[model samples]
Target: YEPSEDALQVEVDTKTIPHTEFLTYVFTDLSSTGATVALDWAKKQIPFKIEFDVSAIVLADIRQKLQGEAGFQRQNWEQAATFAMNNGGDLQEALGWINNAIEGQFFSSKTFNNMAVKAQILQKLGQKDKVLAMVPEMAGMANTNEMNNLGYMLVNMGENDLALKYFKINAKNNPANANVFDSLGEAYKIMGDRKNAIKNLKKSLSLNPPAGVKANSERLLAELGVVI
Candidate 1:
């Protein structure tokens, strides 16, 4: 047997068997008379293998973009909660989403992140004891980002000293990140340490935030009566 660009050729010993019967079988199985036609055209002696070619078969591809769209529609509260928690680390927005999720019964029975989100919502809602209860569950799962988020929640709840500990951990892990400096500055400001606030805020600005963040940081510094 030999393979061509589009087909396979088979050689059979004509002395052993007649070509006509073999051609009929090949044509019947292939569902094409082209193989039989090619066999007749070949000048080689009988009992030779004939060449048959079939076009390549391809299956259609499926795209999964709709699955993502559906997931977003079905989990908007969770998505918004995650976004607000990560971006500004805003407690109110996180709490709003958590409350929405709870009232809507969106994802109340899930694992760690879900529990953490709910605990954070409680912290923002002034349920400090409840938030503290969830801390043990969150401790082993905590990362720099999680610590930063907890720090932000603590800051909003006027627990500046505790907030500083988490923010310091986050800053230590991510020294070059401007948001860490910004968060540390916010913590210092809450603690009534204007000098450290000014210093860290300046460090945040020095890292060269994007245009929007730079403008907002500048406005915040000005509000704090810092000459930035």
Candidate 2:
């Protein structure tokens, strides 16, 4: 069944809660296990607290499986994908599972983040034209995170012009997000626009990027002789 936007929102929110507590509640309050139980809880609860809890559970489960042994992780991911797809999980969930399977070396906190990033890089190396053709159609209809993902994809594909367009859109839409500025800088840098690159990179630094991103930006600045 195609879940409504509201239902999808409910799923996203529930997938954001702390995994342990969310799982405890699922086992205790819901008297069940697995994605079905979590999904059922999502369907039954009001769209407020319950949704948040379910989102947490889902995220936690994904993280756990990602961190496990590689073979086990792949198996679990396939199982999760199959379960989610068969049981009315949305396209986002299915795609997320597939991504998880692709991002190797066991799961870890950064698996999905790294996968998204790496995919963006690969698209740059081999799929620039295709990515440029697809991103605009995906922009508004896709979730914000996924849209940001598309932005990364565009950047990696060396479609800096197109990537900047999406980054600017995301930055305007989410002014508080520092990563948008960082991504914008990368796009500009690729375009050989050092001035704007430095400016946006500074903005990204000001926002206190995640450690990995901060280091990367610093390295890039150093390479450019920007002396940040």
- Total backbone collisions for each predicted model: 8, 14
lDDT tens string, model 2, 93-180? 5556655565543542333333443344334346446445545556755555766677776665556677778878877887767777
lDDT of 1 by residue, 93-173 (tens): 567655655455544434456667777666556788988777655655677667677777667777678788877777777
The C-alpha local distance difference test score for the whole of candidate 1 amounts to 0.62
What is each predicted model's overall lDDT from 0 to 1? 0.62, 0.60
Pairs of colliding residues, candidate 1: 10-49, 11-49, 12-47, 12-48, 12-49, 13-47, 14-46, 14-47
Worst 10 residues of 2 by lDDT: 42-51
How does candidate 1 fare on TM-score?
Answer: 0.48
Location of the lowest summed lDDT over 10 successive residues in candidate 1: 54-63
Q: Report the Cα lDDT for residue 163, model 1.
A: 80
Off by over 4 Å in 2: 1-133
